[model samples]
Target: MVRVLAFLFLVTAALALDPLPPERIQALAAYSNAHGGHALLIRQNGKTLHESYSNGHTQNEPHRIYSGTKAFWCLTAFAAEKDGLFKLDDHVADTITEWQSDQRRSKITIRQLLDFTSGLEPLFGLHQNDFKDRAAAALKAPLVGTTGKSFIYGPASLQVYHELLKRKLREKEQTPIRYLERKVLGPLDLGPQRYLPDPKGTPLLAAGFMQTALQWSELGSWLLKHEEIVSAFKPGNVNRAFGFGIWNNHAAESKSAREVDVEDTLDKKWHAQSWGNACLCRSAPADLIACLGSYGQRLYIVPSQKLVIVRLAKDSKPNDAQMLRLLFANTR
Candidate 1:
């Protein structure tokens, strides 16, 4: 009788010790702020953590999510796939039938475009051009490397992929943006669609996605729960997750713009790779916390603990993770 009681007590204690609650999420937010940006953490199935800082305001304001737009693009593309609009391996060069004559683009594939392995030379850095000029340049751009040799990591690849996506949808009389509204954003109750276009009036898929941090946070939460979406990022998975545009936080190849210079911070696992617009994302402190606590804002996902941490800012420097650690410490 005594042994059984002791065993039951041990199990009960273990369950009670699990570290998941609103308070812990809040601590992550405070810690994020300490890292350098104003922060917030939220829990919706799991915890979401978000941090933002600028101009004496953090919440109740929307900020641009620079590269985070990539996250949005990933979702939209998958939605297109789910609807059988196109296969993941469909060739972008062939899909955009109008570009068939372009020899430089012939070898490119959809997967290459999503993974930043497209060989297309850089076109965005040139002075922004009118739609006609941008289209012409995009069509004729030379290859810097063969398709799929390495990761060049730029917006033009996504932009081209966006064009391909638009073409596939347009054939069905569906606009890419509208499809997103009906599938990804609408169900989540997200709105105030804010996106920018190039001089040629093309939705800038590589960047240009603009929304409040709250909306982005909501989108992130959707991503956390959707296995179909998350499955796209896992290795050896049918999604061929690494090759897809989706953010794969687990792979060794998965790396972010911010990396630790110090050896001490290397093991924290606090450092993870995520892709989002670095300059355009803006959100309230609470919203940031909520988004991050749920989805981990790209790098960290403590599902068992139901925690996430996110950092957003303009001119974000490399030491940002340290600032996040400080925010957590101060919360205590």
Candidate 2:
């Protein structure tokens, strides 16, 4: 009886230790504040361990997640697939028709678009404040590289995906945003999500999504429970560290792994294409997955530990490696 009780106690203690101690949480909170953090939330095994807001930010105030918005569209795509809208392997040319004659464009698949391997020109205008008919513009953009050849991180590829999805759902009168709400956000019970639209009224699929820290945490939770969406985390062949709108740290375990210096890589000219090869945190679990945005916004999920952490900020400054080290300290 004593031995059995000890084993049970060990399991319970392991489960309880996940979100780190209060002192460490306080340290992370301090780190966040020093680096322009607006909000932070950490959950383990479905329980909130820490939640804090600063700089006049409230718990429920909406904040732009920037590139983190990409993950939501990725999820919506999986949902659309489940609903029989189309398969990931389908050629984008099948719906767009405009690309049918262009051999390279005709070979672009829906998966490539979601994974940033579409070879579409990474347009700056799509992200600028002067939004126009982004879908139409994306359709008009020429392929800058061979299809499935390289990973180009930009709004243009996602915008092209928006155009494809729009054409696919045109007969149903369901806009991409509406379809996302119905299939992905609705089931998660997330939103009043703010999706900014272009002048021609197509939702900016790549960026301009706003949700509170709690709301985003809920998304992380939902992702943990959804296998179809989780499957999208598999690393793409073009960028071994990046999947469909998310970064997979597990790529470090692959035989083809290469170093990824985030600062140096991000500094390359937007058009100078390259692929990422390293894990976000070499010390963290290989199963770690992250939804990162331009301005330090982050949603980290570690399935191995049943952990979900959210950090929102005004700019990119926080170090994910350092944060993970603090969170996963050895309690022994």
Candidate 3:
């Protein structure tokens, strides 16, 4: 584990990579702007290289990041593990006692939930802002496949994980929102997000975060400076493309790697989606990780280059591979 250091010194010492040159930023921003993108911000080694906003978007204005919100919740899972709440592989049924009676559900682990491979039905309805008691609803979701052998990407797995976390925190006399506020958001200096709490006051864990481009980059910066981030990118058994609430370009190194517009693939029914050998962009470095949301919200983190780039937009026209190729093509 890398000794926790303020990013200033950490960037200077651990990552000797230089910031993106001026023309690179211009090219990246141009590509983004031409494709309905409203904001493009780039940071490297704890310093802002360039920040741009257009089309009525401002630096401070917040926009919905959608499932990009999952990465933040996943941070809570790691924090809980650090606090000895439970191991990532621990059976979730241990905390959600009612699950113990369900064979497949009882076998699900904490890591499975974060990775979206717990076999729980995707339950897309959980994304609705008014959906009530998401945790309870997720608990009732049945297995769509063998536990640990399926990648059912949706809000259900995360809601169940949240329920388990809530139970674990109760033993410590804490609440989930406070734990997230203190353990995750506070460190990033981000304020309370639009969690969209249900009638039961249980905040939706799968999505509903709204962050400005600059604000979203804060998480990317933290990830670049965190020494243990490599582990967080570990691909799951069911989905080689997703890991711990983040998507990776590890498959970019493969000859069979398919350049995928993730939002399109996710639009298909979970059973219809084929995630095998999916790579965001073959031209990008294999270490690249992304938090992608609907309608082209993006946070691209390249640990190898000590870089973090945020691209926020209104609609889903921006091309991921082309956008990344534009930036990396201008790299020194």
Top candidate (lDDT):
3
2 or 3, which is superior by TM-score? 3
lDDT of 1 by residue, 169-270 (tens): 876798777877788778778763655655656665555445545655565566555646655642222212243434332322233323222222222332
RMSD to the true structure for each prediction, in A, is 9.2, 4.1, 3.1
Q: Give the per-residue lDDT digits (tens) of candidate 3, residues 1-332.
A: 24555666764765677656687678888777877888988887677888889888888899899889998998998899889999999999998999899877888999998898888898889878788778888999988877778788899998898888889998789988899999999999998889898888888887889889888998998886686955666778878989888998889889999998887878788788888899989888888999988888999998888888898898656578988887775352
Alpha-carbon shift of residue 75 in model 2 (angstroms): 1.3
Which residue ranges in model 1 land beyond 4 Å of their true spot?
A: 1-17, 20-31, 34-36, 42-55, 98-104, 126-133, 234-247, 251-304, 320-332
* TM-score for each of the candidates: 0.68, 0.89, 0.93
Candidate 2, residues 1-332, lDDT tens digits: the string is 99999999967966665456788888888888888989999898788889999987889888888878898888777877888989999999998898899878889999898887887777877886567678878887877776787777778888888888888889999888888888878887875466677677777777888888888888788877775667666666877778788887785556665545454576686456466557676556778788888778999987766778899998555577677666654531
Residue 61 local lDDT, model 2: 86
Cα lDDT over the full model 1: 0.51
Best-to-worst order by lDDT is 3, 2, 1
- In candidate 2, position 307 carries an lDDT of 79
Q: Write down the lDDT of every candidate, Cα atoms only.
A: 0.51, 0.79, 0.85
Off by over 4 Å in 3: 1-21, 330-332
